[model samples]
Target: MSYPTISFSGGSIDRADYIRTDPAKLEELKDWRARLVKLDGLDPVLTPQNELEWGSLADCPPGADLVFLGLRDGRACFAAVPEAGDAGALQMGSRARAAMGILGHDDLGIYGMARSLVDWHARHRFCAQCGAPTQLAKGGWQRDCGACKAQHFPRVDPVTIMLVEHGGNLLLGRQPRFPAGFYSALAGFVEPGETIEGAVAREVLEEAGVTVRDVSYVASQPWPFPSQLMVGCHAFANETELTVDRTELEDARWFSRAEVVDALTGAQGAAFTPPPPQAIAHQLLKWWLQR
Candidate 1:
């Protein structure tokens, strides 16, 4: 079996730690450098600006600031920047979203970090314990509620995306929202109280009515579309018969390795193409095909 090579490099670091540190130095630097982003009427968020002129400014609200999970040398680094506007839609003004779709490997790294952390801050404005709003504390690493005195941290939802193979063929499915004739691996969110292996088994069964065995962990990616960490896996299919759940998938079937190769290379037909390489699903398929 020959699988395509995923763009993952061994030296890449997961920058989670640095982003959680004290941003006092970062803030001081920003004070001098004037980091800012200007929103244009709020329909779609405007593009992000990394640097701007720091004018006479008021004190930032306790929790009102931008936090970035920077990856240096492939490890996670957490840092906070001044939150200018709604962190969730801050990139709406930028072309980053559309760029990721068209530019695969190169675009995935930075854009993924920016979008996810910003979204995390957006949804975590208020403390879950008490109704009192929280303030950004610990350099944007935490939120502290003034009323209840509770601490809140950023969260990442785990999802399992698998490539199920049986008898030299891989199972693929298409959701209604996907482009016409586009098909990819079966995936779903990991349910509460379930393990990654359990989630992979359950999602394949639920979405495609296929039973899987010999589940193996492959790789993982940070999909920051609202803060999700996608765990990629390869599962051995016990049964090839696919009973598609129409509610979840428009169609489901098994494709030969050769056919998948053609589809991926755009040799079989122009209509069929996997998702951009930034997506774990696409990377999973690429890995499987190269095997």
Candidate 2:
């Protein structure tokens, strides 16, 4: 069976670091050949063909900071980040969430990166250490603080999302925010200094009361909701018993392999709805079923 593309991960863009660092090269690329990704604030404006709508640099508003997204099709690409006073331009992610249902793979990846970087710039306008305003540098790749001489780069948080199995059954959970009957893999952010395996085991045990072992890596996705790296993993638990943490999960239970197959295949009578195809959790379920 063919698998769906993982959203917002596999981008085919060459981020020309050399161009970003060199003043002359970066300046030269800002000509008519350069493409600008149109954005309504931080949200994407998609073409009717479900692709990213490209515009010329002339289209960008004067005084807008242009971030170098990289080279696409051998042409320099960019996204315009508005000045800080234009708070009305920032959508605060509602539009980007809506764009998810419409974006194709490449556009999804590009927009994901654009939205995250733009959002970061909006939020991190000041130096964390010195509480001083920062300036954009290196084509929006870095923010520099003159007061403390500090440099800040974009951050991507690591989260471990895992499928825990015992006796041919897979464990799934639902949080309060999830729609009714929708269940997905248990996941949590990896604490600082924690290993991937440790995060997987700890999240499962804490949320579902399942002490899972035999942690193994499967795949990963760049979830750009404020920039997170989702580390997909699988682990097996010896016990089928669960101790659901009410604060962490609304519910947690094991489903048989057959039920999981029905969920992934979109057949009726699934015990719970699987995550959408673009989600890494959905891919993990498919991977587990195939294995």
lDDT of each: 0.64, 0.85
Model 1: per-residue Cα lDDT over 4-46, one tens digit each: 4443222233444544464664455344333222212221122
lDDT of 2 by residue, 1-291 (tens): 554358898677898788889878888989989999998877788888877889999999897778898998899998887554224431236677778878888788888888778767877889999999998889889999999999999888899999998889999999998989999999999998899999998899899887888999888988867678889998999788889999999999989999998888889787899998878999989888878
Q: In model 2, where is the ten-residue run with the lowest total lDDT?
A: 83-92
Question: In terms of TM-score, which candidate is strongest?
Answer: 2
CA lDDT for candidate 1: 0.64
Worst 10 residues of 1 by lDDT: 35-44
Shift in Å, residue 280, candidate 1: 1.7
Best by lDDT: 2
- Regions of candidate 1 where Cα sits further than 4 Å from its true position: 1-27, 31-64, 68-94, 101-107, 268-271
Residue 246 miss distance in model 2 (angstroms)? 0.6
Candidate 1 colliding pairs, count: 35
My TM-score estimates for the predictions, one after another, are 0.76, 0.93
Q: After superposition, how far is residue 9 of candidate 1 from its true place, in Å?
A: 9.5
